[model samples]
Target: MNTRKILYQFGYRRCADQDRPSPARHPVIVVGAGPVGLCTAIDLAQRGVSVVLLDDADRIGEGSRGICYAKRTLEILDRLGVAKPCLEKGVTWKLGKVFQRDDQLYAFDLLPEDGHKMPAFINLQQYYLEHALVERAAELPHLDIRWRNKVIGLKRRNDGVTLTVETPEGSYDLDADWVVAADGARSALRGMLGLDFRGEVFEDRFLIADVKMKGDFPPERWFWFDPPFHDGRSALLHKQPDDVWRIDLQLGPDADAKAEQAPERVIPRIRQMLGHDAFTLEWVSVYTFQCRRLERFAHGRVVFAGDAAHQVSPFGARGANSGIQDAENLAWKLALVIRGEAPESLIETYDAERSAAADENIGHSTRSTDFIAPRSAQELRFRDAVLALARHAPFAKRMVNSGRLSMPSTYETPLSTPDADEWSGSVRLGAPLPDAPMRNGHDQTVWLLEALDGEETLIHVPNGGTPPAGRRVLVIGHDLIDQDGFFARRFDATPGSTYLIRPDQHLAARWRHTTPEAIERASRRLKGLDGEHA
Candidate 1:
């Protein structure tokens, strides 16, 4: 998409906090205005918490960065009331095909089901997403977005964090009961606190060229390994909105970084790949990726999320997708802790769960890099053998590393109650509730996730039984009908099968038969208020 067509700028406006005798304290001050930061602020604002979202820039970013939005992220956007614009303005795809030497290895379907509210993935430019989020933030009365406001200094104390925010008018002391550092990878707050990442920076470089063209290519992820056009290197192609296409060509370690991005150097490469000269270059950049993250996401009163706390190689589209999930994971718990509804120690689970997810993304990305740009001759031979065998050998197809597309991480956290009964199926503890199509009492179609909404919920699939009292319960047989067998087959639903889900829609506990006492116990356990656990 042409950025100038949708370009917008926010002017400087003095804040009440800036004019106060002593800077007024906010319930939460988010230290960036990117998609992750904006989502975090909106999530908190929806829960009735006051938020100040600050960013160093006055407008959306320049390039079409992070075009792939996983289904899980789209669900989160639905909760924020901004998924409609994204679905209307983005390209949706699910088929992924892998090739080697101009030959097809195999194709896989990400979401091969019939009853889903959202698609497997949507390819929307990063700037478009930021615009949608900014609009949603403006709708919430509790959210205040401060453009061109940067957090240059941070001090963490025993109780809260105080920040030095610099703006066009002047610098001011902003005290926040809690701080969210969603700045970019070069996080100023992280540097102010003297924290460094720990992991490896790959030696290979890749070029991202966003091209505008009219082509007949289907909306599918096409990954090539050692293609004839770009001999002995990898290339990836994806379609974005407004006829914009994202192309990534792997450059070996020996490539000259400065000269590779010149129009003269880039245009010929495009011509060679497309066998014509009919495409216009939109954005171009050479990037070297790394697999790294902080030792911990939570440090005292200043907690980190998104790129500020972790980073991954661009393969797999994990960077932005995982960062959005981090915002969802931290938003509810942080809001609860601030409201005194949950123990302070509950914040530690955010670090534990998302750190595990970061490690998983880094592992997948690191392996994809190693396979695409092998570090040694032996590894190259192994990759070649796997590619050759993938044509017929089903086992070898799983070995291809064209970036394992992003998926929701099944967390191993302290909040989940161990399954007390013998459950069969993919229902795991601490996993996000898999979505299904359902019908409400009015006989209108709805989604399972949307019915639960953004609050702690009780789901009961009854077998000619009524729901238990003492908690708000959604009885499936009465409140809604399972239009499809997804929930029934997945949860192995029987008479009185019950589930307790957290505010973020993750499964906290389950049983074939549950009582009011069990529901209260699980609620306490989810908040980290259990006497022994806390």
Candidate 2:
């Protein structure tokens, strides 16, 4: 049979499991206990929903992948109460430098704004991040983390989902009101469902090595384009915690992995870059990857998060960060649905919002790849010329700085509700809504984000006087004001700038002035007000 017919047969088999299901009903069954799956399970458990987390691996942190975490990811961890431990355990870097040939000329600092709650970035391995999440999941009584258990089958129906899981001991049948497939790029769940993951795959390969080096290199991310000896390749030297420095070199199209790892092949690059600095190699691998994204994030009852939904080139560290954000967006919506507060359709927005963000990441990473990859002698020459220009030209410096990283995406969709008065620069929808300094209940001032911890916030923008009727209301620039800095810069509130922030801290809506009806409407949409909106 063809692939389509085989899939149709699998679908029928799983549907039979669903139709014959007994009266036992579980809250949620999440497949693949990677960081995304673990995060989803923990978030649901935190919301008081029972969750069963399953993974094929015998233990957490089995995979040696995903080493970088972005600022937005730290915020997601903060929401789950795991960020503090992650910070304590992980190494933080504040500066990044870009180099051309043998000379290093420019540097940029990724410092968190003064008094901001979160840092710019952290370098904790993906396994450590998963381990931290699992620890938190263990504390939540409603959550169950089952390792060495893999999903052999999945079926989606109007009622819910039925899953067939296999263990070393035996195969068992289970049913859930909802299912999330946080499996990686080659998602078995997405494949079984016949969903489309669309994008391009580059043919280039790279070598990443973690080494213990004796060098004068301070803790900073260093990138080299077209260095001596390697005519057309790129290199990254980043220091991880525990004195392990990660070195990445772009191997040529025909470079053999085994040959590249030989002490002769690896040591010279280190010596050339670090100027005869002594170093011992701990681990090495020749890794090749591509950038691609799913055509859709949701198909009926099944949803995809992390690598299952999108894959970006490792250039800008977008893959893991985007996946974590996918979890952040879907977790709350799933909780609301399981709690019977909103329609199951609310989960559909995850596909819409995240797919757009994935596309943006795809573009950014692809551009970074093109600059790093050398196609021909002329092309390599052009790249060298560009880097040489960046050495002396201010415009070239900015161009390289702009491509150094990825940030939170703006919600450009029509589905997104906009802020009242549009202020320029970084505060747009889909951007991070940072906290400004404001007063707390004790009359002592604190950051607005600090003051609004542990609960949802509804800022009331009273115009012509008459406050909206709600307990969650914070009267911005009136009873409450932001005077210190850019706290209310994005809101552009002159007295009346209302915003309803979700528990995940994204702005649900903003208005010049809010009514009881509008506030209730937005709150209900977020599952904060039961089914009142519907």
Candidate 3:
């Protein structure tokens, strides 16, 4: 009878007619309609703001949670216009393989760098990217969504939030200046604001399935490790396009009858990873989830996005691309503090830059599940001597392309700092500014992240500009002749590279030769403005 009375007996109650005066009032609301509250209510109704959204499930990607999408979450669904219908119904991959244990192999290609912006990942299905973000939040007419509702009480006064939803046309009382909680990971609003999520949990448990195979297997992403059968555990194998497949076993550590993972123990572990090659089933389950976070992600007019502010461990797809980059960094700073045009300490830098990119993506997904399942035995012989020097050099292929993971940044937070160019080598001020290629006025090619779609760009560079007035800046000029030389060796614009980005593109602050009074004090503390800026 603990854990705070079993999370207040899974609270979320609210009803018995409360003082109802709201249908709107700086109305924002949001709260879990999945895919980080429908991409934070279609990026706060494409910044016009006035959202409602809510949801207790009544349509919208019902389960089989977060399939996988990276490549910076398809460049943030191509900056919220829903990435060409999620790349024409996803399932594109360049390559991936990784097995180890007597049948060694280590492929991996994920092509990128040709009109950049996105490539290297996309295998869609988390209810088909929540059916294209609830069909672009049903063509936002100032967005209203609702469905089964259920925010069940929130309160927080002095300027906004009242919540206490419940609908099907019943309990109400909404009033909102803000309230987002892309709810999940047991986040009944971060357990009704008692906060503190913390982490570490892995007594092994996983089974996932979703068969219907016919293998020649090569739609990439394999990852085995001690697999000759489920006898030694670990197996992943995803490919879901039309031929469908998405396994993932590993029930070890006291596998208490996970409802007996049948189909004769999963078609003999897909006949030991494809020896007998016959397949056809569809879906299976057995989760045991754990990998936490949340020690704060704003809590006043209530806030918290994606897995209600962090969950990690779906190994490197970083929980719905870090909850759609925490709803594109809290939808345009909660639509410029509900249109009063900022200043609310810019929502305290969305809990200090997404709680420091959710603790560096939960310490790189708990070190990729402790370097592929190793909890001792001297950390599995130092992860098999770094996978036997990552199978022979090229500095372990750039250390497996720096653990092939992306999107998660920070610049020491308090809305980013570090400027006075002490520039030397490895500058990691809120990393992620990699794509390049250019030319878009009508001569073809593009990608300085396609002019950082829908808001907050300020790139500058090529002798960085003087922006900071209603912010937009994307200037990149420095003659690499606007489009080739591999995007001038990956975004080579050293005429004092600026960058500001953030609209879920990451890198929220940078400067090498920047000063229009430090871009008007980091654009008035990242557009949450209020006075001071010079």
Candidate 4:
């Protein structure tokens, strides 16, 4: 089937141009209708903020790019009300095996323990995910998505930003309180703002093929170093929905990208790997990898997210996952600032937090690229030795880095209220809330994360103590029952312990015992109101 036909079937409709005059101003304007842009618009709209989403194209993504979504990303999507469709249409897996020239070196289980709500990773085509997000965006009344709307120019102001949008009929001007640029790696908005990325561009290229075939390959990730079937380089295989599989083949810098993508060249390669299995090529692309990011994500009235803020190698699947996290991190802060509920300085925390995450992703992606495509002979020999030792030596197995899979970045900032006492669990104050099963007041089993409905929640493990009173702060003990003790063991909760959770479900502060005054103080500090906390 043709790729365009698949995209059309997924409901990519051309939006009508506005016949009326453009609005004088919008609360938020999101550039690019890709996953990150659509997610940002949806998040802000869900928070009661009006948003306008723009995209140059009238369809979803063209190919199966960024096919892997991490668990943390899935949680963020769940909050956005699209995780159910994503989970149903994607292939979930946690086990991955690494091979060195057809010999299995070792295997790893990303989530060996059960009790978590989401899997380690899900493999779904980016187009499918984006289509789902667009459908969800349509259900919201506060979000206005304009297709074939291109951002031709932008000017940042002290109070707001003005953008020149070009539609098929004509061009119009739009003023926005805030601008979120998710236009992707080669962002036109970034170029218009005279911003550039600073980092290393590896001298290695990769070929990606989306092949459809009837096969029995398990849903686990399989990676190989110098595979015998392909050339002496790295390769990766992942299963997606619709009997389509994603395959990556390493092509040296000097390889001809066009020639490699040709059917005459790709068919023989697939035959060699699948041993003459019947298959059809769905899509193909060749591109180099770069580990790069802008100096700052937030620039005055305009901000950047996803590929516009940072670009990483595909080895770790960090691009879209981190981008979704970026949308989650920025949405609440932006909404608060726009509604005058928080000071403008609160937006600065988005930079401090996401920049740290970008650095972590870049560091890991760079290392993975170096290990997969070593430049020097000495480096290759060292990598080979480590791979050989990983077959038997358990210690060496830990050193093998086949793309240190994507994980959430812990933010150590003033926005997070540190623990006043020692803790003995994996979940920390600055980290996102770990998932656990719980029973609600109606005796319905639900995940702990489900209780956090985009609002600040105060959790207390009752020990014959009265709970605090607040207007918007949800008291969990009143409606939640931890019948299985999973929350206690996972969070190290004790009698009289109080935990303050932020709107994004991240732990803001925790204390052995606390009063309502202390909780209010921490909450104020989280919004950048308290001087000392700021």
Best by lDDT: 1
Report residue 152 deviation for candidate 1 (angstroms): 1.2
Report each candidate's C-alpha RMSD, comma-separated, in the order given: 1.7, 6.7, 18.5, 2.2
Instruction: Give per-residue CA lDDT, model 3, range 408-473, as digits (tens).
Output: 565476556665555544335555566667776665666766666666677655643444446566
lDDT for each residue of candidate 2 in 122-176, tens digit (9 for 90 to 100)? 8876667877887788799998777666788887888888787777666678878
TM-score of predicted structure 1: 0.97
If both were scored by TM-score, which would come out higher, candidate 2 or candidate 3? 2
- lDDT ranking from best candidate downward: 1, 4, 2, 3
* TM-score of decoy 2: 0.87
> How would you encode candidate 4's per-residue C-alpha lDDT over 1-534 as one tens digit per residue?
234245733322343434446646889999998889999999999999999998888876578878999999999999999999999999999999999988998888989877788889999999989989999998999999888888999998999999998876778788899999999999999999999999999878888889999878899999998889986888899999999999889989999988888988888888888887599998888889789999999999999999999999998899999999999989999999988889988889999999999999999999888889989999898888989899899998888888999999888988677665878877787789899888887888889888886777888877787776764543456677777777888889888887888888888888888887788888888887876432
* Cα-based lDDT at residue 357, candidate 4: 96
Q: Is candidate 2 or candidate 4 better by lDDT?
A: 4
Native-to-model Cα distance after best TM-score fit, residue 375 in candidate 1, in Å: 1.0
Q: Which residue pairs in candidate 3 have backbone atoms (N, alpha carbon, C) closer than 3 angstroms, thus clashing?
A: 153-164, 343-528, 410-430
Question: After TM-score superposition, what is the CA distance of residue 486 in candidate 1 from its true location, in Å?
Answer: 2.8
**What TM-scores do the predictions have?**
0.97, 0.87, 0.36, 0.96
Please tell me which predicted candidate would have the highest TM-score against the true structure. 1
Model 4 CA deviation exceeding 4 Å by range: 1-6, 9-23, 471-477, 532-534
**Which pairs clash in model 2?**
none
Q: Which regions of candidate 1 are displaced past 4 Å?
A: 1-6, 464-466, 532-534
